[model samples]
Each structure stands twice: as structure tokens, then as C-alpha cells.
Target: MRIISGKYAKRNLFTLKSQKTRPTSDKVKESLFNSLGQFFAGGQVLDLYGGSGALGIEAVSRGCDHAVLNDVSRAAVAIIKKNVALTKEADRFDVTNMPAKVALKVLAQKGRKFDLVFLDPPYAKQQMVKDMTAMKQLDLLNDGALVVAETDDQTDLPAIAGFDLLKEHHLGKTLVRFYRKAAE
Candidate 1:
């Protein structure tokens, strides 16, 4: 796969040939970034259930200061490391081989708050619900932070309390839902 824009535009990245890993499509990534506008610049991002580390890497390419990537699979972590190295972004990222909740707890303990968080877990796992819930409970999100969730077009995300749904884009079978934290 390739980075769609920003400093790393058209740059080639690494990916693993595993059934569990599904990289976000270029079209979807492009659309998501375009909508992000200036929000991605100089932000801290979290890529939960990160597959190829594509989303976080893209954020860094667009000027995000740093990204923390978490995945439960060892293979996914390895691929994310390879992709980060391929983009020469090893210094801008961290990879955790653990479930989303575990990673969330660790980040919260570290007092880390992200400006943007990407969630694209396996659709059937109903991971969006659990991850968002944990994020809210842990208060890991920054005020006015953005959350991007990619899921099968059919999956319905819960109406999270602290977040306001910003936009929803349906690109064929995949749906990208954008949300922003509500003012306190």
C-alpha cells in the first residue's frame, strides 16, 4: 500500500499477507484525510487495532507529532513495526501487542491524551463499541479530539455520550464515521 498524501505522499509502505490484517483502502484514506483538513497537523494520534499501521503513519505524514499503535496480534505488531521503519517513522510511533482495553489503560496511566484516534477493528468483533466505551471511561480523549471509525457498512456504532457524530461516509461496503468530542 502507499501513503495517499502529505510529506509521505506516494511513498510505499509494508504490509503482511495475513487474513487477520486488512489495510484501509486508498480511496477511504484519501477521503478521511481530506475531511481532516488541519486537525491532523501537530496532533497526537492513536491507531487502535492497527493493522499495517497505515492510518497512524498517514497521520504522521500529514504532520501529526506522534502515534501510538495497538493490536492484539503479534503478526500485526510486526507488520506495523516494518511499516513504521519503511516510512522512516520509527521515532514517531510506538507499537503495543495487546487488546485495546489493556493498551487504553496503559496510555491513561501514562497520562497520554490523543487528539485523534482511529478504530477499525474486525467488523464482526464489535470492537468499536468496546473501544469507545473504554476510551470514555478512561478519559483518554482530549477535548475536541476526533475519532475515526471504519466498519462494515452494516455495523451500527452506539451513540457514545461524550462524542458528537461529525460525519459518516459510505464508500461501497466500508463506512467511515467521524466524531468529535463534545464540549464539557
Candidate 2:
């Protein structure tokens, strides 16, 4: 896969060889970023269920200040690290090898917050609502923070209480939804 825009536009990224991780396609990634304003002025990003670190790295490429990429698989983490190193801005990334929930708790303990978040767990094992709820309880989202969820069309995500569904798009078999956390 490759970065779609910003400083690292068109830069190639490495993905895991295993079927355990699925990298976002270039078309879908480009469209998603375009929907989210293409680039950012400055903001922190969290990439949970990080696969190859493409989503988070793309955020940094598009002007987000920093990104924390987390995945449960060692192979995926290794691939993510390699991809981050390719950016030559490794300092802007924090790679964590852990389950999504565990990583969120650790980040919360550190009082970390994010202006953007990408949640793309395995389609069959998506717990997006539960995860978003954890983020809310941990106060990990900044006011108006954007949460992007990638799932299959068959999986329907309901209107979450603390988040407003801003947009939804269907790309092939993939469904992308953007939610804005209420400014509290």
C-alpha cells in the first residue's frame, strides 16, 4: 500500500504477509482522508487494530502531530515499525504491540487524548461500539474528535450516545463511517 496525500504522498508502505492483517486499499484510504478534510493542521491520532500502521502513518503524513499505532500481533507490529521507519519520522510515532482495549487503558492512564482515531478490527470480530464506549469513559477523545470505523457493509453500527454519526460511505465491500465526539 501507499500513502495517498500530504508530505508522504505516494510513499509505499509494507504490509504483513499473513492473512491476519488487512491493509486499507489505496482508493478507500484516499476517499476516507478526503472526507476527513484531506489533511490536518495539527492533532494527535490513535490507530487501534493498526495493520501495517498505514492509517496512523497516513495521519502523520497529512499533518497530525503524532500517532500511536497498536496491534495485537507481533508480525503486524514488526511490519508497522518497518513502515514507520520508512517515513524517517519515527519520533512522531509510538508503536505498541497489544490488544486494542489494553492499549487504550494504558494511553488513558497516561492522560493521553486523541483528535482522531482509526478503528479497523477484523470484520468478524468488530467491537466498535464497546471500544468507543471505553474511549468515552477514559476521556481519550478531544472535543469534536473524529472516530473513523471501517467495517463490512453487513455490520451495522448504531448511533452511539456520545458520538454523532457524521458520515458514512460504501466502498466495494467495505463500509466507512465517521463519528464526531460531542464537545463536552
Candidate 3:
């Protein structure tokens, strides 16, 4: 798949060949960003389940200052690095090869707070709610931070306190859910 919009719009990205990884298509990515926001001014983004770093890189191309991309698979992480390299702005990104939990902890320790987060974990093994909860406890989310979850049609995201459900869009069998953290 490739970036649909932003500075990296039309740029191609690399994805793993394994069936375990499901890369978001250009059409769905377009719909997802359109619903969230066409672009951003300056903010940090987190791609917690980064398969190829496309979402994070797209955020940077759209004006976000920085992005942190993480994945558990080594091959996926390598592909993410390659994709980020294509942007020619690698300094705008931090690539981490680690499990989501470890990545979150490390980012928290570094005092990283994100304005946007993308969660597209495997549909069969989802821990999105738990991940978001940890983000809250670790104080990794900025006030009003936006979290987007891309999942299969069968997956239904439950309501969580302190977050407002902003939008939901269905592109074929893909389900996209948007949420905004409440400010204290």
C-alpha cells in the first residue's frame, strides 16, 4: 500500500509478505484520515502496532513533528525502517523493534506524550482497550489526543471512560473507530 495524501502522498511503502500482517489499503487509509483530519499542524504520533510505519510516516508528511513506530516482529520492524527511509526524513521518526507493552513503557520513561495514536493489532489477538488503559496510567497521551483503531468488521470496540467516541467508518470489511481523550 501507499500513502494517499500529505507530503508523502503517492509514495509507496513496504510491507511484510507474511499473512500474519495485514497492511491498511490506500482506500481505507484515505477514508481513515479523512474522517480523523486531513492534516495536522504540529504534534507527535504513535503507531503502536506499526506494520510498515505508513500511518506514522503519513502523519509526519502531513505536518506532525514526530512519530514513534513500534512492532513486535523483527521483519516488520525492518520493513518499517525501510519505509521510513523512503520519506528521507528519518529524523522525524523513531523506530522501535519491541512488543507494544515494552515500547509503551520505554516511551513513557522517555516522557513521550502523543497527540495521535494508531492501534491496528491483529483482530484475533486484540488488546486495544488494555493498551489504551496503560497509556492513560503511564500518562503517555496528551489531553484530547486522538486514538484510531483499525480492525476487522467482527471486532467491536467497547466504550471506555475518559474518551469520547468521535467517529466510526466502515470500509468494506474493515472497521475504523476514532476516539478522543478527555481533558481534565
Which is the better candidate, 1 or 2, if ranked by lDDT?
A: 2
Question: Least lDDT summed over 10 consecutive residues: which range in candidate 3?
Answer: 121-130
Worst 10 residues of 1 by lDDT: 122-131
Candidate 1 shows a clash count of 0
Could you give candidate 1's per-residue lDDT for residues 3-113 as a string of tens digits?
Answer: 887777798877878887778988888888888883354989999888888999899988999999889989889888988887775888998998887899999999999
Model 2 TM-score, all chains together: 0.97
Which candidate's lDDT is highest? 2
- lDDT tens digits by residue: candidate 2, 136-159: 999999998999999988998877
Candidate 2 regions with alpha-carbon error over 4 angstroms: 123-126
C-alpha lDDT of residue 8 in model 2:
81
Residue 16's lDDT in candidate 3 = 96
Compute the lDDT of residue 171 as modeled in candidate 1: 88
Tens digit per residue, CA lDDT, model 3, 1-184: 8887788888888899999899998888888888877899999999999998888998888889999999999999999999999998889999999888898999999999999999998752248888888899899999889999888888877887678888889899998889899877
Instruction: Rank candidates by lDDT, best first.
Output: 2, 3, 1
